[model samples]
Target: MKKLTVLFIAFIMGFSGALKADEGMWLLPLISKLNMNKMNDMGLKLSAEDIYSVNNSSLKDAVVIFGGGCTGELISDQGLLLTNHHCGYGNIQALSSVEHNYLKDGFWAKSLKEELPAEGLSVTFLKRMDDVTQKVLEGIDADTEAEERKKLIGENITAIKEEASKDNDYTVSVKSYFEGNQYFLIIYEKYNDVRFVGAPPSSIGKFGFDTDNWMWPRHTGDFSMFRVYADKDGKPAAYSEDNVPLKPKHHLPVSLKGVEQEDFAMTIGFPGSTSRYLTSWGIEERMNVVNNARIIPRGLKQDLWKEDMLASEKVNIQYASKFSRSSNYWKNSIGMNRGLEKLKVVDSKKEIEKEFTAWVSASPERKEMYSDVLSTLEKAYADRGKDLKAQSYLIECMLRGTEIIALGTRTLKLEKALEDEESDEKVKEVADGIAASLDAFYKDYSVSTDRKVFSAMLELYYKEIAKEYYPSFYNDVVIKKYKGDFNKYGEVVFNKSVFTDQKKLEAFLADPSLKLLRKDPVFIAAKSTIKLYKELYGKVAEARASEAENNRLFLKGLMKMKSDKVFYPDANFTMRLSYGKVGNYEPKDAVIYKHYTTLAGVMEKYEPGNYEFEVPERLIELYDTKDYGQYAATDGSLRVCFTTDNDITGGNSGSPVINANGELFGLAFDGNWEAMSGDIAFETQLQKCINVDIRYVLFIIDKYAGASNLINEMTLVK
Candidate 1:
């Protein structure tokens, strides 16, 4: 770790951190850094042009964005796409009940006809992209205020989208990359009405929930299956029972050949955001304060909520998604905090600052520029502290509410009704809107969610912050205000309080006789606070944007360092292509990931009593029989491949790990233990990615799952 930091420090100063100098190398800036080139003789072959030129037209056809969900890719054309099971867990859970229990039973369509249609799911592909930075940032001057700049960017994007899609079957979106300096208009064909093809039980999909999240030597089969659907004409359309299977222009072939160390591999998918370009102060704040003080504590509340849910079946059914969501972030924060700690990011930052200061002392001109840059960054970090507590509170407050989308729908109906002049028309529209909204609101939102969040918020306030910072007698006031009046807050939130045994909440909402009190003071205050928080959130977003621009300038330097060195900008949750080969890693003192896990490990980790890692009897039995056929490994596991270096993050889950021939060899699941810090700092020495070998996934589909009928649709190379 010391050497790691020292090497990084030397690189930062010696290489001048010039963006262009390392161009066309495997060492991506932030989104993903190139893995240690153990196979290429510690050399990088892929150029910036190769990376930037990769597109739908360049890669195998099987890779597709799961669309409307997290990123995923098609490993086989026969509708056998592999994605992080958690990504599809919601729909799986949504379709499951105590009777069906897909999460427990594991859904295998058995046949194409049996594949279930997921109501709101969709898949999208980026057909093309054109740089539109000039248009998006056009006419913007140094004097442009944040709010005005945002509005202008929005207006320009709208216009660009309209013009770019003039003769295409795709929808156009203008994206900001490198902050506001670079923009790309992405044209995509969105296919709605994707169906749930299959999935291993939670035991296979999410084995080891919180207990094993973000840890390596992992044995989780976090894969889900879905199939895209379209109208009979093969065009994007709304959900219909009669919708036909989508015929894609490109779908990657399953690579039975496997990925060996440093074999050329790449994943073209949407990788969410990264702030590798941020100053050391930014990383320190995330590590020491923002993520630790705020995210971790709130995450603990969710854990508590889940524990509460599991204790009661009814609560489990109601707050399942809330619990799952909370757990996800909780695990991520844990990993993030650990990475920051292990790397001693704050210490590293201080060292870098000291070195830079000393370097600046050698030259007057350099000293002035260095001072100005540090001053700018310091001011930004200082300003970020003012609203930290308030912002954290705002998230907690919203977590205890109804579906925002449903709320938006309700607001729209109310606005329309208020605008209508005709009594009958207004009545009809309002009634229909209200009736239509009932199921979406009731089914999607859990009443316990609000209870859990609100209680957690209260606890967080007390547990984390200083009492003096809070209003005088805040605790006493809350207790007094709600004393013997349980219905007050409950009625405002869920029209009733499921968290308590209060029967008066229903009476309160329905009582027309006391309608004036319906505008409860507490409810009104909550609403006003929510509105103010939202407005403040917008300002925070703008401020973050300004800081992002400064960071981009730093990154841009990396790309422009020297000619002949091409650079693929690190991912920003936009589609990116990272090419590498299958490989094992040697993390300090001979820790190695020789081969990937198989279906056997799925059963090995299963604990019948533990919901997080429990494997079902059927899956265990299948694994014991060596049912993998051709995909079976000599090492005895399912034969998933390993990689030493790749840049990926949470959003990159289910991204297709393609081979040099552009065949789908593996579905990227997670990064290795050493690479945990890759999210914050890309250490080519430490940043290795773990991918589920495509062969294992295919074997599951063809043999155990019995969905081979779908396999006929793909163009299999082997």
Candidate 2:
């Protein structure tokens, strides 16, 4: 702890003069020394220890990693957890049926017994974190080759993790910070018996859908509730009928005090990734190649799926999650490209690089280390550009775009097991695994829907990518035999392939044969595409590796050159804290935006039968009667959502937004559209985090849904 204290002091002394108040995703352990004073000035009443402490219960005890990618916070001692509705959308959809379409009508558990178990869902609590940098880089330095350096670091991380978890059930991992310049060991305890408690319907949860996904003045409820369960002994365990609600160490008291403009606000959660240190060449490649690849193909696929989904209610239920997932990113890519180009982010990076290069040339030692960093980046990106589009198409089309391909590839491992003549027991195990997976796989799968997707995406790939990069089967089969008629090709494959039908696949697996699998049309196409992708990937491996090393060195050099500028590491799905104020901004000239939206706005946007804007009958009744209960503001308006300047990204979805007294006031959900470029380069003026006002969450639960049982579970503060 003393060593960490020393490191914190050093970091603050280096950059304190230039650090902006609201710009960083800071490490929690350094808050007492580096940030407490400023936070106190901003109206924070709690000490740093109240927010984070390794040896006692604190705010960190309440925050949990939701599912695989989002964040959740415990709101009650009974382990009542709250997160964004979109974060729980997949589970809600999975549990839905045409008869009981929860996604459309919403759901609420009247009692603990009524809560439904979400299979395979889990929540994790971070126990503590320790700086392990010295141990991780013990024998590695400037002279070490990239390959060897990686190998040594991997070994060290494994050993450290093993040591940390020897006597506890904690899931431990060592993560690199600052591009491997620093490392920390994090420990987490995971609970697997999480259950779905309640959620508003998609109309409210996803009020704007794709249209208002990342926009401001949002009125979406955007929240869901779950409960964690533990074994009789109060320890982590798999699902069991005998399990009970967990008595957590800490849970946030919900605040009814609400928010005012410039009120102190903070968010704590796991952010997925950000490449803020990317050079100009990297930014160009991302904008042109990666973003374009995602936006174009996904949009095409979504259009076809949307038509099919709208035609039949059952089909809509089947494709709801898939369509939402695809369109979310498709819209994001489009927004990011627009933001980058409009904001001149590439020009900003170029100017930074120019300054860095100039600074490097002035010092011989720095020149030796960083002289080739920018050159390496430019050449690597240029080389990668040759095959980047081809690779994207392969992923979007063959691997992801076509459902039959994914289903077909699942049998490859069993085929390999048969080829190796594994034991009968092992063979049965593989067969059983495939059988279990098919139930969930085919539940939402539609042959006709996927057939259309395959045809459209395959044609797009064939027309857009070069022939030399095409998989062998494309040339030998589709182009050669079918005369490049992807429609006919899709028809034949869907009708003839065993992968399209669960019964057919099961029968084939019962009496498996390698020859049959190898001859299957879907499997053949998948194999060919994967094989070609591997070959192409091998070609760019060296250049990509060199680019990584050079980028790491460049970051190291830049930190020294700009010693007075605060530097936070790029996000890698790790927990971080960001603080700011609840403030509004002008996105463009003469356009002033407010800090919050109210229930009146939701009513204003309501269209009787429109999917994205439809309001539930009960919600309309409540609005018409002004029945907001205790959740309405001083002006007798129900606040729906608000904005904050806190830095956040993708995985921060569903994060808790706490006030100065460490009470839950809102849930962080989306970033404003004008600042989609925030991931690559922070836009101080335009970057704002949109949050669902916690009071709005309660209003819907108590008044609209009549779920007072949930209201009783939380500890509310005025």
Highest TM-score: give the candidate number.
2
Which runs of model 1 end up more than 4 angstroms from their true locations? 1-57, 75-80, 137-158, 167-169, 312-314, 350-371, 397-435, 444-453, 462-522, 538-549, 552-570, 586-590, 599-604, 635-637, 640-644
Candidate 1, residue 81: lDDT = 63
Candidate 2 residue-wise lDDT, 310-374, digit = tens: 89999999999898888887888899999999989899889999999999999998878889889
Off by over 4 Å in 2: 1-9
C-alpha lDDT values of all predictions:
0.59, 0.89
lDDT of candidate 1 vs native? Answer: 0.59
Model 2, residue 43: distance off in Å is 1.3
